[model samples]
Target: MLAQPDARAAAALLALTAAFAAVVALLPWPAGRITLGAAVGAVAGASLLVDLGYPGPYRLPAFWLPFEWLALLGLLFRAVRGLSDRRVGPVGGLLGLAAVLLPLRFSLRTPQGGAAWSVVGVLLSLLPLLGVAGAALYLRVLDARRERAVARARREQRLEVARGLHDFVAHEITGIVLEAQAGQLPDQEPGETAALLRRLEEAGLRALDSMDEMVGALREPGGEGGRDGRSDPPDREERADGATTRRLGLADLPELVTRFGATGAGGTAGVPRATAELAPETAGRLSAEAEATAYAVVLEALTNIRRHAPQATEVTVRVAPGTDGTVELTVTDDGGPSRRPLLRRRPGAGGTGLAGLTARAAAHGGSLTAGPGTPAGWRVSCSLPGR
Candidate 1:
């Protein structure tokens, strides 16, 4: 009752497997043995497929069935593993399917009893195959998840580096630019000019320090995400040389304002002297993320003022608790003309700083806005959620 075998379709694989089996059985030479061993799965799959389709009473030499069945099990395992690779996946899948379905071929020979036997045989074969395939898929899933996690960690590191450059380095560079401008004032005394140069050097040094901190953080394995899988803040990192870098936070606003005010002290007309009105309650209530964002908002505002409104006589930075559980930050400058004509706003090139701060604030459930002040000045305001 065996089904008619498709001799034409199965001929190639049959020949290949027979040739390999013959060499292993007769010659026993190392190369022939190695080749047969290396191709055992393919040989087994081919033998099974041919046997299933072979139109004869006596199957493919009973001696080969035991070896072929064992090898077919191995082939099934390999097929599951190969599914992840695009190159050999199709071939492996086809061969594995043939090998796995070989048991069902029995219904052709045994009439009524064969149907029940074939189903039982297929279910038994499937139990082991499912176990093997499940393990392989589980491992692959873990690997994919790990790759995604590493990619996410690296993206966060890059963002931290960008923020450090923008918040700290840009602030220092802007101060340097302002100091250089103050030195160029026509009636400035030599002593005052020398003092300005010193401040410029200090700002340059601070910018360099910030760059060094960022570079050290990048060089560390796992970056701000510690090797132990703990994610520390970008500001809390140790250098390769054992030096710790301190982050400038809300507490540092007074010093930041003083330095900014000093940058314009030597200028003749409407010299800008920045002031800070930081409320203790707001500072104490804000979370670390909100505090950092608030600090950046102020830093960026001050930097922009130096670039665009250097002649403003009054500049004020205010931080206070807003209605609800939110902290509000405002940096306002008395609208005045730019003394450094060279630093005049290039049309459409501004707002990049504010845009960056806006994104940073929004990431922590906060918002930012910039527009003309009540009477005559530019105003930048940000509201951030608290703890």
Candidate 2:
């Protein structure tokens, strides 16, 4: 531009510089669409000047083509990243399309009425854009998949915490309700009311324990308790026999299954045949969260079975080490009549028990699946790392 100090050359240089800067600075912003509109207007004006054969040394775009290339690359990237955000996406699309066209202005020049050269030039100029478009489209698809995965993970985590609360609170609340009903004995015997009050106190205290553990699980890591709320479970000394404070694990599953089966534990006589196949070596290796999750999985499955399939007579609980160093827990039951199907308790503030169990399993970098068994019944199976 300095070699030819004409007014037209100077003016064209100024316009091109401003156009390049505007494209670079404004295309990624909320008001980016305005920038694209201005660029289109500039291109239209430049085309008119060329048609009128405007005499200007700046007619050659050599000084600005590099700037356009850099801006297009940056704009294409922004378009890929911003596609998930509605505010910035449309502007990015328009800018990327415009960027591809800028090169065509120089490359697609054919002599007047030169039909064969014009067709070849147009094809040559447009071919490169297909590659750029393909890359931008692939990146957009990947971004969408990543967003969906993150959303799914968050939803599952919310349900897991809900399950922790539901499982513990439900167990304690069941006890409390039963105790309250027993306390309503019509004829008061000599110390019956006092014994009932003691039972109520125990039930209420268990509920408090459940609340603590669940809240601890919900809290952010390193700010409160360990993962799954109670990473350091109570030792044998801390767990008194027959005490509600007893720490649960694979070892306690037999008693839990028996309790669920016994008629006195709020089920029909001979509710089901409960069996266990827990690995003998799995007494202590599991992290607190994993162990707790395993227990919750079985508890919820049994609860569902008792509620949904009362006539199921055979249940198998298995805990074993997987070949891939994960702990696998499975609870399966033979088909049963749906006794009093509508009588099943409605889900509380937390979701249905299985949803919670699924969350818990996933939290441990494991998974849980409950589906129909080979012959007839249903199976709830899970695999998770110890940590």
Candidate 3:
């Protein structure tokens, strides 16, 4: 469908052409000036004729000259006006009028009472040309607008895919990194950390899995998914796997906290104490994209706490179930660093992490905000649509 702006622009161009033609036709030139005026007008009108597919009326007999001049002039104005407005209808109609008027003009011009007939003929011929031009312009405008809208939509889809890749895969990979550093994997030999390395490799593979999915979607014919402008049905097996994967929602926050504790064991400062408050199925109900985004937000927050807030003894992960069927996940760390630095450090420190999180949230009709917490430390929170 043609958008409102394109439709209005096309209509305005057509209306202007019609009005200009009407005014020009109503003017009266003296008999002595008629031939010169018609000649000048024809030359000026001919300038616009190239845009038409055929030559305009200047070929009619002497008796029909006056009316032919009017019609040709009107058609020329309509064609030129349409071009100025980026429309095509007027040009097409002008072309048609040229074909009719050129022959009639060559045959009709005479010294007698042909002036009145010329005016009537010109008006009548130009009217149909104007109509044709208006229709062509409208269709062309609609087509151009539709192409632009499709391009914009495709760009948005790519950004969403990038966000999803960064959020889901990055977090899962970070989790594996932390776990490996903490020596949580089963030890196979006396001195070999082969088992831990294997677990880390497994985590890397999982990250790869998410990345592959995103890449597949991006490379798919339509950008997001599918070719030929159609979406495939959700695979039942994939949905089942996704449901199982989403089970690691807020309820698993404690385990994540413990894992952080293990990573921070060597230092004098302890790992931050964190908590989660969320509904049982809130994570599952969220679209795959939204869940991926939420996971990334939480993951980035934890990563920041581990990297920058080493002195912080308590970090809280709170997932509040909002009344409006949304979940607010906040990760607050009690560490020293004013609000300004927290804000400034985000772009420089987090790099693609924060940006990716923001894109992911936006894709799912959500928002992510990060800044300093109330009393002390930093806070990262995301308001995500729930299932």
Candidate 4:
């Protein structure tokens, strides 16, 4: 209901008056004591007229009966409007129903007691009330749908920001961790340690840049930008180094593998060297969404290797055409000793990185799997649909 004091108090007063009148009307008073019944009916009629702003004479003769019912219906309409927007209890609903039916009391005042006229009159009044209530109910339903749509849009935006942070910052941080560990090796030369420090600086800068781009995406009125107002194509975003770059895909894997190999923990010869064997013409065969998801699969697998099996001697990243016009990508590491627990979960089976990539692949009509590879290794692989 409205917050206006008058609206609140009047609705409450009218409801109470309706309940009192109903009790009095139901009582079997002596026929000679007609004044008591008149008093109760007068109270109900006056309250309805005042609350509904009738502003006419409060006469109860047969002539002004129609106006009285009109005022009562106006009260019903207002009640329906208020109740439709609120959480009413069962008692509230029953009281509201009883209040509107008070118009039937008008029949007892007519000469010869026109009970049939009262039934017809009240039934006719209810038809319009039913329509108004239905309309109010429909409007309430539309409001609920609009609220749900807003909630859904907000949820998707949050997920997009979360995925971007996970993909970009995690990759750079993994590189930094590996570089730090490599610099700490006992056999490290001063020159090699200085080079690792430079790489660490670059990785830290890249992570900061990733965060800035994410904030910019949020502040930009619409979405990730292009020269015009239109959105940039998928998986492409502005980088710290420049205005725009293909953040991931077939074209980027060679550089990604190079960086992973360069960050070899404990030094170049001590840790696994990463290699890429990407098929020619595969980029032209895949859609942007599928290609980006493929790139994410490779990035996550490589990062997992750095975290789980830093001592693995051989790391291989391969992408090729699969059966029936599909592109397949795989990353495998020889199950070497790990700095962490030996009983680690397979990267593809369950990890935040791989779990997100699995959803992305499935969205692009593909699937991912991770488990033991041939001849003693852990492998993460996925396939995506191609043109």
Candidate 5:
């Protein structure tokens, strides 16, 4: 059965049409009028049946379709009179008119005679049918236009959310990294440098966690509500109060590596050799955006290794503070050659994985590069502004 229209306006229109059909069926009429009225009522009922949320018989006699014609005319009248605000136009109108008048002509005359009244009926019917058909076609065009508008609006909203995430998270992470770098200078006290690095890691990890939640909301079903609430003073205050203090940063990278290694411990990949080299100060200062970017980059790369380079026995992750104070993350695997390498892999294999990584990196004013490494393995690397 056809799915019922979900829009309130469409449902209301169907209900109104069904009511009109019932009235027409009950009205007094001559014998021929009674027959036509019954037919029209049947057609109306059938149309409304589509809205009852059940599958029914898929076919009806062609002769019975005259009732459908009448229903269409009713729809056209409703459309023109603005009684039904639905945009169904000339195509529906024409079909509806044809359904009514053509059968009337066919019934009035025998095959051979083709009487004058029959001809007149046929011709008169054509006029309304043509008008209604044109209107239906117009309405269809309008529907297409409306659909495009809605889609564009949704796209714009997503981009806006992406932009906000980049600005807030990237900026914060960059600051953290800068402070860590300053502490690394020879003149800075060792204790102070260590403390700064720890704080930076904490802040970056918190941002990363928050970003994951935000991204989840963006991908939420039906796109109801996923926006940056940071503009609200209360929300900002709460953020300042360190809701992210429990976040995981570079300091946690070793744990992440160990966890993955444990998962593969008994498998053919054999303990999944792994390493992490994130500078302590740099790790502490990472921004949320940078951290999130780094996390995603590592996650996707490692996932690709497991899925596509399952034979790889060792994986190495190298994260460092860049000369420009950005965070550079690289995931390299010493597995058998990639079945479908990142750079020149089979079409569909490379598209979704690499494209998502690229978009994530670009969103944070960074870049991601993935390809076959020099020593016959795969490598995924990303560089993002530090916190």
Candidate 6:
């Protein structure tokens, strides 16, 4: 009066199990997926060997079910380890497919209690295999996001340090060099005493102070997220930040204007007079990014004028903010002599300054263009989105 087993149910279960296995096999990063696959193979081989040798009364061996569950646990471990690669899924699936056979065989053996029960067993066996694949995929996605975030943070830090070097430290050093050059030497004015020594001492102190701050900024943790984009610790140097009253902006243009005369020129041929025009609204309210970029564009342009256009004079700088929420900065020099060719002995000579500025602009979702100007000059200009 026992129930009759159904072959149709067993066949359907096997088909579903095979489909699941195939889907899992094709996953990427298949390295450790095979571990579960191998364990499944081992279970099938051992089960078949036991069935053949002791075919008498092994219908429901207590040890067989336990081994099967243990194998599934090993499979879960494989999935976790192989999370970074999708390729392991398919191989793992194949192992699970083999495992389904162990349960299928048990169902096919019993007289009245065979196929129907086997189908249920096969479905349960396939559940853990699918679970592992899903877990691996989740881990892979999490790792990828972490990597991207780290890379972005690193790029920002690099821009911060580079900007500090060019905008803060370099600008201060250049001014010191220029002032020292313009000063009368001790030998040139022998009778001059305390005043000249005092000026020299003050200039030296400023240079040293500026350099010490640059080094500290570079070393400080949570790097350079200040108004001026410097790297000091929070609140320690508020006045030192560009947000201070003396921060340079369009308002400082007149003070920045100077006449750069060619070093060896006779009279006026090589001397260039520099001028700046700032739109009335361009000052006081610009963001740190805009002010930094605009200041750098003008500084680099002037530096290049001295370095390459020693024979040409006349430079013009303009700062204008547009109605479309963008600030435009331009620096042009009336055609100076061509920049000197690269000194092959040095690794990077004439290219790094412009490249650094280009990177800085792009990081802020802005653009800078530098090339020969329309009529006869070299132009460096940038447009930055205003916050």
Best by TM-score: 1
Model with the higher TM-score, candidate 1 or 6: 1
**Model 5 spans > 4 angstroms off:** 1-252, 265-267, 336-350
Question: Which RMSD values do the candidates have, in order?
Answer: 7.1, 9.4, 13.5, 10.6, 16.5, 9.6
What digit string (tens of lDDT, one per residue) describes model 2 on residues 267-296?
332347787788976767677657877888
TM-score for each of the candidates = 0.73, 0.53, 0.55, 0.70, 0.39, 0.59
lDDT tens per residue, model 3, 234-300:
3211221222123234545666665555444212243445555555646455655565456567777
Q: Taking the tens digit of each residue's C-alpha lDDT, what string does model 6 give over 337-366?
A: 544321122455456777888877887778
Q: List the residue pairs that clash in candidate 4.
A: none
Candidate 4 structure, TM-score to reference? 0.70
Note the residue pairs that clash in candidate 2. none
- Cα deviation of 30 in candidate 1 (Å)? 25
Q: What is the C-alpha local distance difference test score of each model? A: 0.67, 0.59, 0.54, 0.65, 0.54, 0.55
Better of 3 and 4 by TM-score: 4
Where does candidate 4 stray beyond 4 Å? 1-92, 95-102, 108-117, 223-247, 266-271, 337-350
For residues 35-133, write the lDDT of model 4, one tens digit per residue. 432433454455444434422222232343444444444433333433334332332343344445545544433324456765775677666657655
Between 1 and 2, whose TM-score is larger? 1
Instruction: Mark the regions of model 2 whose C-alpha exceeds 4 Å error after superposition.
Output: 1-17, 20-28, 31-60, 84-97, 103-142, 223-247, 254-294, 301-387
Give model 5's clash tally: 28
TM-score of 2: 0.53
Residue lDDT tens for model 1, 1-387: 134544443344444555654443343323544543345445555565564555533333333444445555555454454344552355455545655665655554434335676567667877776676677667777877898999999999898898888788977876776567667768777588678778888889989988988887777443444555575564555565545666667888998898888766333453576789988887567766677778888989888777766677899999888989888889998856543433645587555678888998888988999998878878999998888
lDDT of model 4, residue 313: 77
